[model samples]
Target chain A: MQERKRTEIATLGEFGLIKHLTEGIELKNESSKYGVGDDAAVLSYPDKQVLVTTDLLMEGVHFDLTYVPLKHLGYKAAIVNISDIYAMNGSPKQMIISVAVSKKFCIEDMEELYAGIQIACEEHNVDIVGGDTSSSLTGLAISITCIGEADKDKVVYRNGAKETDLICVSGDLGAAYMGLQLLEREKAVLRGEKEVQPDFSGKEYLLERQLKPEARKDIIEKLAQMNILPTSMMDISDGLSSELMHICTQSKVGCRVYEEHIPIDYQTAVMAEEFNMNLTTCALNGGEDYELLFTVPISEHEKIAEMEGVKMIGHITKQDLGCALITRDGQEFELKAQGWNALSEKNN
Target chain B: MQERKRTEIATLGEFGLIKHLTEGIELKNESSKYGVGDDAAVLSYPDKQVLVTTDLLMEGVHFDLTYVPLKHLGYKAAIVNISDIYAMNGSPKQMIISVAVSKKFCIEDMEELYAGIQIACEEHNVDIVGGDTSSSLTGLAISITCIGEADKDKVVYRNGAKETDLICVSGDLGAAYMGLQLLEREKAVLRGEKEVQPDFSGKEYLLERQLKPEARKDIIEKLAQMNILPTSMMDISDGLSSELMHICTQSKVGCRVYEEHIPIDYQTAVMAEEFNMNLTTCALNGGEDYELLFTVPISEHEKIAEMEGVKMIGHITKQDLGCALITRDGQEFELKAQGWNALSEKNN
Candidate 1:
């Protein structure tokens, strides 16, 4: 055994660790046409069209152990995995969870986690089939794998969007990210005041959005109901601009998001102004919204615009046009994606 | 944050840690009638048959870093996951892997792991669809979720074995366990001798079995080719006798295994004798062979017997009669399953 000085992981950044960890993955399975390099991995199953997506959430990195409930963590883990599945335009059917824990957590904590997981399962109507459990050397870490089914025709790829397609996003933005900010602020107060009640008034919606953000299964169902098939789709886990840039690079298309069209929850808007942060920047770059972002032919814009859950944000453009955000005054600035790049993202 | 004295997990044993971590799990998915409470979880998918399987291997726990080549570890991890699919009598088509690594492991080590994974994927014709990567606080922990397909009529359950059915196992018994024993002994010798090269003559097969185990996907295929579906089946990861006992318990049937009929390779037999360990104990309780153990009706027994890669060991009996092992001299002793209960079995 070789003994060496241990270096803190923070110094390497998340991307560096991912790069370091996945450095030697050689795809041996024919089904693995793509692995570890995209939003979701592709698999070719015999006689069936299938998609598999996975996400891992670690305590402290993904959530604050103090303010976030364990049950919510479980629910969020399942939702995020499903988010990837939804991004593929597939209906999720099953999930398997693997958890690693240390002594600090108790059976009660696991119960809460399961409670949230169960709630998500009931809401999504997916089965909780199996999972693995082990003790971690540190805090908690969870890996959830979601199985989804889609017809070969219905499955959408990140690269499928074409120039001139109408860009749309479901639900509102900035709420979840702002909620996280509020929760963190509350945690700071709770740390100082031994017996003070948290000021939760006026921030309930945003806080709930952050703590219990739901995947767009309803939007997925709604899209099906409307007989609308997006040319391309993705769930908003990273900020709006980041996901857009992904679409831009992958689809070989650019986009122009109108600033006025970006939806920000009222509380999120106020919070952003209170914090001296730009509302548009928070909407454009804040993450964990769990909303669906999709694109359709320009002909479908009026049809999609009337929908209850979706909002039109931009239009895809030619490659040379580049991705940009247009202000209410009509000034356009080049869009830079600030999505949580696992490579350099700082762990909270 | 609450600060506490650090406690070494080794003091708790594997079972204690699993119990501590899983105590709070709540199964909310209607399809998840069971989770973390059975050998394999049952999940009902909409418009599809139940998809199932598992996998998790920790470096220090399942493999030693020094002698275990990185390629073998990667390949072995894939096999173990694929083996779970085989145990369900399902055709594994895709898998997602999540890996946690410490900086101590280099990029070259990761490449070695992926190389092995690729080899297994090619051999199995499965896909390395997707996976996640992160830095570990300590040792490497690898987990894989394998997805497979099965016809409703062909799916096997551990609870389906019946009384009077023939008990069967594929390939040799105890070889992997014996191989592990041989490697441990060699490691011990090297640790003590310092300058001496470990002896390798007459130890090749056993060592290979330990370092590189195969998933019996071939056996599943061959069984299907012979049109012989097992009444029940599971992989031999926790030892042959224990798996048999599980089949007995789950199926509510007893079994009588013949010591003379248990397949033993020449290398395993010799090593048992050399180590002065009971060959019967090794074959009965040794685990990690990744072979299939199943049963067929007495009438179907002949059909299975004629197939290549199968050995009939015993017959399933009535539950009241109980499970037992018959000696070469006709002495019948009760068989108590000594499976590796990761949830409760102390490593010691």
Candidate 2:
């Protein structure tokens, strides 16, 4: 490994620090007319509807720095907001990031963070525009706002699902949650609270899933190419069941997803078993998957099922039936959202 | 005050809390196609250039709850971002707010904050399209992203100042800084560390300036009415001197401003004297004024001079001359940007 250079953030001041961090950023989106070095960024989306979304990630609450790398944290932060735009069936164009950090972070730390942000923007073909940098008294706080564009007719909303539509999800679930569990256990062992070394020999995929989740842009593109506009769509951030319930409530319908149809990675299942946890429960309610969950017309079911990386998990039903799940053993049960309740969790 | 009601935020959870706070919000902007209850808000500005800006406010850094009311803090937060749009010669259309609070804040506290945000949106004819709510482990964190629009030809940038342009500023300076000083003094006294009672008898304007600063939307309207477009523009958030240097550096020009002509309120001057601080320094370097600092073509000097709440304090000069402040006694001193250096200050 190369020796890392460190510079204290205080020496650069706010303006100097921002300039240093954003100096190399190049705008890739045509909509972006002006980027950093301005009080505000100028953009134009003359022929498309603009999609806007924001996400806030705070230290000690949303993430644990003890096991999470700063670069991966930054990458995940940007991906989270970009995922929202993709969930709307839009192409992300630009983003502004606001960060408040305490004295504990040095200039090199911010550079590493910005490097991850830059990589995400480059890979997603989005522009890093304007943002604010300040100091916090406690932990680091990151707030990202992403701007995207979509054709007026292509923009999808969560309230548009209809009865009989097919519920589909891109990518597997619960791997990220299992990855987090592994990291936590490893941390405990490192602190001498446990003696076992984490057996992560074949669990690289799980760690990647948790630390560097990507937005399902490919899924969006594939759906567009297939001429399939989802009746309703949202990104699975707060677990599959929670997101499914959101779609059901907004669309005024119910859904029945098959437990057998829930996709889970091999590593995730193995980790869940090793941890003595219910694999089905984790797949249903473990959040941070960053997968696309959508409902499409039943007519397109066969086409969607044939597509790569997509699973037709269920079908929308009448509102009276309520949201439910059909177990692999032919038993039906009502589904409950056990996603991260940030406020209540904090109180506890 | 009447008896206040209290509600625990945990009872509603994150999703319910967001829904409750935004329940009464009505979309007034034509560009806003969707609001809340979605992964992303949809907007369109087919014929206009869009302007985007973001600001992050952290507890104990940008503000102190000890003296700053939650309502006023929210109001000021919204105004600060809106001011950036107006600074770009655009009308704000929509905003997305992301707030993370600890368990210490209840639902009622959030409601008060949202009430202030609603009032600002209502008065400005802007829509609160979307936001994210979550829990923080420490203090409250707020990030507001504002989107606005303007004609392509009418949008202003800071890098357009011409040599010999007339530099103008709306309203007064240093008042916000004075207000902050007063608040700190009162806080110290309240802690019993200082015996003197705060002598804020007739300095209500200063207090208001610090607590509830308004964006200069009226000035933008007035400039439009008079058919005068600034050659360069930006809001005076980081005091006049700092913002002026930015304009000068970006425009590749220099400036000369008369220290005597810089606008300072009587209360601000009196308070500076009371604190034994230099009044001129406060006016030149104290930030958070939320006033517009702009430069118009020299041809419009007479028109701008006659306008209400505007003072022509200086003129742009060739780059060779450098930025300077000419004192009443005819002494010329190079201007320095003593804006809020958050990192260095925190380190100290």
Where is model 2 more than 4 Å wrong at Cα?
A1-3, A192-199, A346-348, B1-4, B192-199, B346-348
What global local distance difference test value does model 1 have?
0.72
List, residue by residue over B267-320, the lDDT tens digit for candidate 1. Answer: 999999999999999999998898889888899867876877789999988899
DockQ comparisons of all candidates to the true complex:
0.06, 0.77
Candidate 2 per-residue C-alpha lDDT over A14-97 given as tens digits, one digit per residue, 9 for 90 to 100: 999999999878877789999998878999999999999998888988899988999999999999989999999999999899
**lDDT tens digits by residue: candidate 2, B161-275:** 9999999999999999999989988887789555455677899999999999999999999999999999999999888899999999999999999998999999999999999
What DockQ score does model 2 reach against the true complex?
Answer: 0.77
**Candidate 1 versus the native: TM-score?**
0.80
Tell me the lDDT of model 1 at B339: 56
What are the lDDT figures for the candidates, one per model? 0.72, 0.91
Measure candidate 1: CA RMSD.
12.2
